[model samples]
Each structure stands twice: as structure tokens, then as C-alpha cells.
Target chain A: MKFKNFLYIIFLTTYYSFSQENNSSINGDFINNFQSYNDDPLIGAIAPEEKVLNNAYLNVIYTKNNFSIGLRYESYLNALMDFDSEFQGNGIPYRYITYTADGLEVTAGNYYEQFGSGLILRTYEDKGLGIDNAMDGIKLRLNPISGVYLKSFIGRSRTYFNYSEGIIRGVDMEMDINEMLRIENNGSYIFGSSIVSRFQEDNNPKFNLPQNVAAFSNRLNIMHSGFNYYIEYAYKFNDPVGSFSLESNNYAPGKALLSNLSYSKKGIGINIESHWIDHMEFRSERAKEKEFIINYIPTISKQHTYTLLALYPASTQMEGEFGVQADIFYKLKKGSLLGGKYGTKININFSKINAIKNGTSFLNDSLNIRSPFLSYDNDKLYFTDFNIEINKKLDKKTKINFIVSNQKYNKDILEGKTPGEYGTIQSTIGVVDISYKIKKGHTIRIESQALRSKPDPNATKKGDGHWVMLLSEYTISPNWFFSIQDMYNFGNYDQTQRLHYINATFGYIIGSNRFEIGYGKKRAGIFCVGGVCKEVPASNGLNINISSSF
Target chain B: MKRYLLFTILFFFLSQYIFSQEKLPNISVKNLNGKKVNIQDINNEGSPIVLNFWATWCKPCKLELNTIAEDYEDWQDETGVKIIAVSIDDSRSMSKVAPYINSVGWDYEIYLDPNRDLARSLGVSTVPHTFLLNEKKEIVWEHRGYIPGDEHKLLEKIESLVK
Candidate 1:
């Protein structure tokens, strides 16, 4: 056995042997999914040498009083077809030891943290998307006074199994004005500020590069009885970043401003959010793109739940994009004529993103990078979406939902296509969902959805075509569920390419444990959780998943 | 190799033993009003409580919460239980949570776990994961995923705790 494995065995033995006499507690959870792949030339799916791939994660945490330590073991046996190939090995990538006492906390090792809406610095792990930016080092948090909070950390971002080359140092402080001033029954105002600096060795051969790049952000939040407003502004020093150019060496300052306002009542709510970002692509490595980001630029777009509506999820354009979103939700009173027996709920959402206008000397003169007006060039539209939905309960046994959406996606910009190559796509989607309670423990749900889009006439027919999907799910309360779904591409320009993707699933749950078996021809698409996305390739496979938690 | 196998077997048994006595961690989380409170202090005054981990963007999480909301009043009256919804929204969508809940008219205590500190401590990897705690705050039962009728199972689990 490897030395590390041997050490782990010895440690486990000692811990378990002495656990009966101590009050310390150890708990863990695990999830494993295995798939056997079959290649299909029609949809471009390939099988690896293993023919079968499995992804498993195990997390165990040991807590004793106010101190705890935890670690996660992950394995990707010849990673799945669509997942990142860098995760084709097993390792203990996450481990941390933390102690808290007397309003003070300290952590050493891997940790995830966020400061002020994560505009400037946020480290987190989203295993489904294969994104774990946990910082590896030390963090300290202290609360000296009743309403004051302070935290500071210095670390290197974790990349795959190794740490990044750049060193990250940051501090954040938040103060509650109401609490600090002891103002009773008054509105609450919270103020926060953060500063983050990254230092990377200058290795570029062509031009001068900043060895130390710094970013700072400040935020204010005011809340009073159903009214809330939050705003944050951030600025980054001049640094050369990857902007899809290998030969160009340009340094530019980055800036971002995000704001949110909301007013909510008993049954009605309205919120408006807007943000402007300019040259704000910050990464641990200037040459890296997409994955190794140092800051998170929130996608100010609605996260659609319906399958058809989510087909064209929006990705944030880090270079420069101005976006705004608004949402309104209202509920019809119960026992009213339009409301039926129960209340009817209606939701409307709209969002738009546009490319920011750049100055002529933005690349040549670093000082000219700043734009005061934050103007967006109307000619270049990145994305736009507007959707509305209504949910109603017809009777005690039945419920229904109706939705309609209109979306315009810039294929050239969002998908990284050549400029003016694919131009844009305009799509309209409609969906209907109905669920009926047949008995106390038996229920059935049916979902029908369709998407119609204007395809690019200049290119060969592909995914940008009219599509329809039908899904039916049956559930036996508390234990079992079965589902079958089919998605048909009926408007493919090429006749032979039009096909139906079908899938079936069976699942059982028993007290914190779940087992599922599925057989399906999966479609090629981008699956997004919350703006962060992963591309899943087409596959014909038998899939099995097991998960449990304590 | 045999030693490694033995370690795995021992771990499996040890995990089983620990899980049977699993209780809520004392991780701190923020309430809807932005006040900090420890998870261990969030009891239902000796009544059963349901701890649900969810997010605003998760479809199944919304469905599960909505379904439970429809019968929450009756569930509370019958079992004297409370349901606490913990949102793992993070800073990305944390601003929308308050409005979203108000608009949906869900009458459940909501908490914000921006960094997922509480979630990681509790080993919750995905949303729509729920735990049923008895009067003593010991995790008696848990379930993952939510279908249309999953709330029936939750109600039954709470009833079992009462029994």
C-alpha cells in the first residue's frame, strides 16, 4: 500500500478504537454514480477505454465540542464523456480543521468563503459542475464588538489536485448600524467592504505584467418592513487578462457595479436588479479561461425551471456586459372567481444583456479603459429573455401550470462563434404541467413543452430547430417513482437528423438512502444549475446512482 | 490490499453506528432578518421539526416547498411541528430570496446559508434534501428528492415521530 493509504488506515484504527471512550462524533455521506456507455455515431457520442465510468464522492466530518475536521474523497474512474478529463483520478482534495470559541473562529486548510455578494472574491465548490475553488491556507474571523464582524484570509486557489500559482490575500468587514447604535424598532442598515489582492510571478516574455493585482469592493444594504435595497461597487487595478487573444498584451482596469431593489407585500412582490461590468475577467492565472476564475460575476438573468425554457441558458460575458432583470409575482385572492377554490399565482420575469461600448484607445492606452457613463452599444445584443407563468389549482385533486417565454440569444457572442457567422436566434417556448392526485398516496404528473425558433439560414441545420417534449411521472408516496420522457426534434432541416430522445427512470427512497436506475439516450446540451453550467454530451447508456446521508 | 478492504468494512460499520445518533450541528446561520443563530438553538420547543435544505433556483426544491406550504397549517396543528427552510442560495441569488418567498406566500421560517457553511457541516450536497428531527433534536428520518406526492411521506414521517 502507498504510504498515505497506510497512514490513513492507522489513523482510522486509532480513532475508532478510542471513539467508544470519547464524546466526539463522526458522521459522513456518500454518493456514487456509474454509467456504461454505448457509442452512437448519429449524435456524436464516444465511449472511453473503460467502457464504464463511475464518479463517487465521500465526505466525512469529525466534530468534538467546538473544534471539527473534515475531508472529502472523490474519484472519477476515467471521467464520464462530458465531464472535464482533469478529474480522471481519485484524491482527497478537500480537508479542513476549524475551531470556534468565544466569538472567534479559525480555520486551516481548504475552506470556501464569500465577501459582499461575491463580486470581488468568492470561493466555493459545486461538484456537479466540477467547480471547486476552495482556498488552501488559513482564515481568521473575529467579532470584537456586538455588531462588528471582521475576517481576513490569505491562500492560494485550488486547481484540480494542485494549488494555483498566484497567492490571494483579502479582508472583509461588516457592521450593522442599527445594532451598533442600539436603535430599537428602526430600519436596519448594514455596511460591508472588502479588499483582495493577488500576486503572480511575471513570466510573460512579450510585455510588462503587473506582479500584484488588487481589487476592492464596498456594499450597503437597507431593510425596512418589506422594503429592501442593496448596492455594491467594485474596482480592480490594471492587469493583463485573457480576452480570447494570444498575441495581444493589453492592460486595463476593471470595474463593476451591481444594485438590487425590491418591494414585497403579503401576496405580491417586485424586484429589479442591474449590473455593469467592464473588463472584469479576473483569474488566478491570466492565461486561463472559463474555470479558474478568481471572482464571480453574477448572471443577472432569470433561472428558468421548465425544460424547454432552460434549453438556451445564458452565460455571463466577463469581458464587458451591461444587464438588467426584473421580476414581479402576484397571487390572486383565494375564493375569488378567477382564483378558483385556491389562489392563483402569476410570475413575470424579464432580463436583457448588451455589450458595453469600448473606447477606441481601450487597448492601446491603459488609462482610457475606464468608461464613466457605462454605456452599452445597442447594436450588439448579447441576450434577452421574457417569460410569464400562471399556476392554479382547479380542484382539491388537480393542479395546473401554464408558461410562455420569448428569448433572443446572440449565437455569435454567447456561443463563441465567429462574428456575424451565426448571427442570432429567436425562440419562443410554451409549456403546460398538470398533476392529479388519484389517491391519498398515488399521484401522476404530465408535462408538455415546445420550443420554436428561427434558425440561421446560412448554416447547416442543427440544434436550433423546433422541438417538443412530453414527460409523465408516477409516484407512490414516500417510496417509489417512475418516469418516462421523450423529446422530439421535428423541425430539423435535414430529414434524417430529426430524432426522438427517449428516457425512463425508476427510483426508490428509504430513510436517507436513495437508489435509482435509468436507461436513456441523453441529448447534448448545457445543463445549468444557477448560471454556472456544464455541457453534457449525447450518450446511450444505462445509469445507476446511489446516495446516502447521516 | 486486504488491510485496505478491512478499513473500508470498518468504516461502513462505524458510519452506521454514528448515523443512528446523528444530531444537528451547532453551525451558525442567518435568519431572514439577517440575525445570526446557531442551528442547535433552533428547536421547536420540544416538538418535531423538519430541516429542509433548498435553493431558489432548484425546481424540485420549489415544488417540494410549495406542496408542503399547501398543507403546512394542518401539519402544524396536528403534530405541533415546525418546518424550517434553509436556502443555500449563496451571494449570487441571495438578494432574490426574500422577495421570492414572500411572493410564494410560504409560511415557513427561512434562513440564509450564503457560504453553505451550515450545509457543509451537515454534509448536505444537494438541494431538496430533508431531515425529520424528533423533540430531542435527534435526526430520526431523512429523504432526498421530491415528487408530487412526497409531502405525504413527510407528513407521515412527522406523524411517526408523534407516535
Candidate 2:
């Protein structure tokens, strides 16, 4: 055993020295988030018993000559206050080895992949959302011919540190007609198809569930000089799903259609997107909600960056919803009337979504709600937004951004309340952001925002009051930044109960390393990444995050 | 435990020596024209390249690129440096990238990493991540997170390469 150990050590040394002369290399990144909770009565923030919670992740990869291996180590010391308790452990849950050749590649262990806009399958990671559903099996990617691509994978979806009970398999293929058919063209025309399936044993006592369910998707993409068009349609067979309520059953077929058309140029752009999803909630394990998501529904709503504008962010309804969004962008000339000294840019966006019109399923009336294609339940509007933004630069060192928007959010649907329980929250929001450079290496920015909410006489929601936000940030070139923000629910119907949520943060960055610390009162609400959301209890805390990449 | 420490330190140094001039991984990203292009093919007539990792929803990323846009033409004329913006927008906002870039009237080349495959390969955890490459396409310098006036440092790096 001693001789074997010596030989191993010798081999490692030789390998290390040889790597220095070869193309072998290593790269990794690290991130740690630590927070200390404290009780607060104002915002109803509560301290967890653990007092301090932490989450850390590290990724290491080594590569050499068409071969690579990677592993991700995650530690959640009782998990953070916002994360699910199931992730309260440490493990190397993600590890993979991949080999690449001229036209083929293979990966084993864990991998993230997607197919055709991810309407059918998209396995990825979002640390903030506590989601990492990489498949733990094998994947194959092949480029058989010019402009032809094929991919297939068989695996089990990861849930925290463990794999789900269901087995997932999928295959995707794409062909570029211009290249495969040898057609002469200045644009690209591609056609793709995908099939994703899941298998799990059915032990439900109330209903007979499908042991295997498959979904198929077809898409087409066309791109010209300044115009692009893409469309995808997906269909899934009737499968009885047992939700978190293990005994309940919903046998429904799923269908989804999404399309986007856009045209753009140097100074002008316009786009329109529409999608309708019906009974399309899919998971590797049918009982899991957002935990083992085997597919991703594109959230068509605009992603806002302003502090107040993001409070009532739109959520995608996976069961049945139809939505459409249109965006228009135009830039006025530098010297034009509306453009001012420097050019001004105008952006207009409008989006509307409604519950799909449905009736008893003709095929299975007792189990499913059937809806016609593109059918909209006009009375059940889920969400709607109309916003416009104008950005202009007054001089070389001064710039301003102004936005005004009106939105109607169905609180009942978005917050998972009973239908019509809280009705709709309609509000008008306005924001102004200004930035000025005082010196070559110094800058300051100020943002002010207001949201006017129409009160609900018969509802019970905490934050529907009129809100105003003020923020100021000072950045010292290349190194440090400090910001303070206050969100005040000033015009609450219950005037005595109004609250101000103030937070302050400081950060420093040197090279590829960054460190940030903050003290704040967090709001209690549904925290979402992309369209997936989870409720996070309110917490008063001091938060620190440090990250480094090499 | 001491032996393990030795092994770790040795391997760390070995990696640095080997990857001091590491090239981008071989991954495919979609150009603004919605066509697949290999990472090695994105360049400007053998000039130094700047591969910026950004996202459509990231405000700082937009700020960084917008700040650089003001002097892009002059920088190109002086150092022949080309800026290539890689947006890691998922399917949720992939379709908006082209319009967003065009409305800003930026002349830089744009690529889309819908699945963030390229971003992951490059060890980019945050948006507004910038990488500078020499004529040989080897990553020479990288900076994470963008602060106002940081573009000057980037310009300095490019100037040194051409000088």
C-alpha cells in the first residue's frame, strides 16, 4: 500500500508538470452569501432560530485537448432565509465529464441543456431561485452534416441534493435549409423538432396516472437582414398529474404556441410576441411544482430594473393563459426638435394577458378544461401594462432616463389567492433617473419613483398603498460604490400603519473579485427569477456576498 | 492534510502557468442575424477583441456598453479594437436583444447565449463581465462588474496591445 501511494504521488507530480507544458488548464469561481437575521416589529420581520444562515457555491473545471471535467460544490448551512429548507446540506451535487471531437461530443453525469425556446425542456440553474435541475445521466450532441445538429439525453432531474423519481429523456434536431440544401441565400432558415418524455411509477390511490408522458415541439426560424420571425408549437399527450396534493388528479392534455416577429435597424426597432399555453404545467416528477421543472415557459413581459416597477412583476400562468406584447423603439436625431443636444431614445411597450377561455374537455369532461386555440377570456384579464420610456443625454457628462407606466395586476391569480378574492390592483408608476460625472473617476446617480395604487375596499393585502422610492448611489471609479434606498408606503389607507423600508449597501471590486454588504428590511412577497416564484418570509438582516472568479 | 495542501498549491500554480494565455472555449452563439457562429470566428481583421458578457435585463451591463459606445469609433480608429457584446438573455427575453441593441444605435457586434453556455464556459458569474483578447484571441485581461469610468482602463489595455 505504501509503494502504491508513492507511485500515485509520483504520477500526480509528473502529471502536474506535464500539464504546464501542455494545453491543460483549470478555472473556477466561488460565491458565498451570509446573512444574520434579527427580529423587527415594523415590517413583521422575524429571525430564524439559526440566527445566521449561509450559502456557498464553488465550481471547478479542468480542460485539456477536447476533454473537460467539472464539479460544483454547494453548501447551504441550514440554507438562507429565502431558500427552501430541503437544500440545508452540503454536497457535490453537480459533476460532469465531457469529451469533444470534430463533429460529436458526449457528456456524462450532470449537464444543463435546452431545446427550441425551452417550451418542452430546459434544464438550468438559478442560484438566486434555489433551482438547479441539471440532468444526471448522459447527453450526446452530434453534427452529422453541414447545418444539421442533433442532441439527445436521458437522465433524472435533480432536486436539491437528490435526483427525482422520474426518468427524463429527450431528443432534439435542427436543420438549416440554406446549408443542408445548398441553397444560396443571405439569410438563415432553420427548422427544428424536439421530443421530451418523463417516466414515473404511478401509485396514486384516487386515479390511474400515466406511467409515461411525452411532449413534442416543432419550430421554425427565419432571419433576413433586419427582420426575424420565429414560431413554435408544442403538444403533450393526456397525462393525469398528481400535484402536491398527492391524492388529487388532473388528467389534461397540454398545448402551447409561441411566436415572435421583429424588425430592427440602426435607429428604429419594433417587435411583437404572442403566446398561449393551456394545461402546460410539466415537471419531471408530476407532484413537484417548480422543483423539477422539465420545461420553461417564456415570460413575455418586460423585465423592469427600477426598484418600484419590479414590485408587481408579471408572472406567467402555466395552467392556461394567453398573452401578447408589442415593443417599439425610436431614436430622434441629435439636433432634432425632440432629440435635444444629444440624441434622445423613445421606447414604448404594451402587454396584455388574459385567462384562456375554457369549457369542459370534450374528450374527458370530468378531468380537464378544454380551450380553443388563441381563445381569450376577456373578463378574466390576468395582467396588462402600458409603459413608455425616454432616455436623453444633455451633455457629455449628464444623462437622464424617464419612464411612466400604467399596469393592472390580478392579485388573486398572481399571488395564488382564490379567484376574485383580492380582485385587481391597478396602479400608475413614474420614475426618473439622472446620472452625472463630477470628475473623471467619480460619478453619482439619483433615482426617484412613485407608484399610485387604487385602493381595494374589500380586500386584505399589505402593500397596496401608494409608494414612493428614492435612491442615491455614489461610485468611485473601478473600485467602490455605495447606495441607499428607501421605499415608503406613504399613502396607505390605514395611515397609522404606513412603513418605510430602507436599505443601504456598499460594494468593492478588485479585478475578478467582488465583495458586497448590506443592511436592510426585506419585504415579504413572492420572490421570482424568470417566471418561477417562491414565497420568502420577511427578514431583517445584514447580508454579505463575496464572489471571485478565475 | 499538509500533503493535500502541497498538492493543491502545486496544481494551482501549474494551472496559472498553463492558462496564462488561455483562448476562449469552442462554443456556438447566435449572432444578431440569428445564425450560429463559433467563438473563434468573431473578430475584426486580426485586431484585438473585447468580449463583453451582458444581459438584456442587467442595467449595469447596459450602462457599461452605452458608456463605451460614446468612444467606440475613436477607439477602433486608434487601436483596431473590436467590441463584441454577448448577451446572456434566456428564451424569456432573447427576442428583445436585437431591438434593444439597435435602438441604442450601437455599432458593436452582438451575439446571443440563450442558454448561457458560453458564459458558463468562461467562468462568468455576473453580468457586465468584460474580457480583453489580444490579436491571437487569447484572453489577456478580464474584469467583473462594471463601474462608471472603468471603460478608460479598458481603453488603456487596448492601447498597450497595439502600441
Cα lDDT of all candidates, in order?
0.82, 0.84
- Candidate DockQ values, in order, are 0.53, 0.55
Worst 10 residues of 2 chain A by lDDT: A359-368
Tens-place lDDT digits, model 2, residues A1-550: 2343244345445655676455566777889999999999777788989899999988776666677766676889979988889897766688787888987999988899999999989998888888888999999999999989999999999988889899999999999888888787778899999999999998876677889999999999999888999999999887776554554456668899999999998888999999998877778887666677778998778888886787787888877789999999888988888888778988899999898887323234355446888888888888899999888888989989999999888888888897557778888999999999999979999999999988445566644578999999999988999999998888877776588889999999987899999999887877776767778888888999999887
Write one digit per residue (lDDT tens) for candidate 1, span A469-532: 9999998878899999999988876687688889999999876788999998988888876677
Model 2 ranges off by over 4 Å: A1-21, A204-206, A242-249, A359-369, A457-463, B1-14, B17-19
Shift in Å, residue A443, candidate 1: 1.3
How does model 1 score on DockQ? 0.53
The residue-by-residue lDDT of candidate 2 on B92-123, one tens digit each, is 88888898889888998899998888888888
Q: For all the models shown, what interface RMSD does each have?
A: 3.1, 3.9
TM-score (chain B only), all candidates = 0.91, 0.91
Candidate 2: residue B99 Cα off by (Å)? 1.5
Native contact fraction, candidates in order: 0.52, 0.65
Candidate 2 local Cα displacement, residue B81, angstroms: 0.5
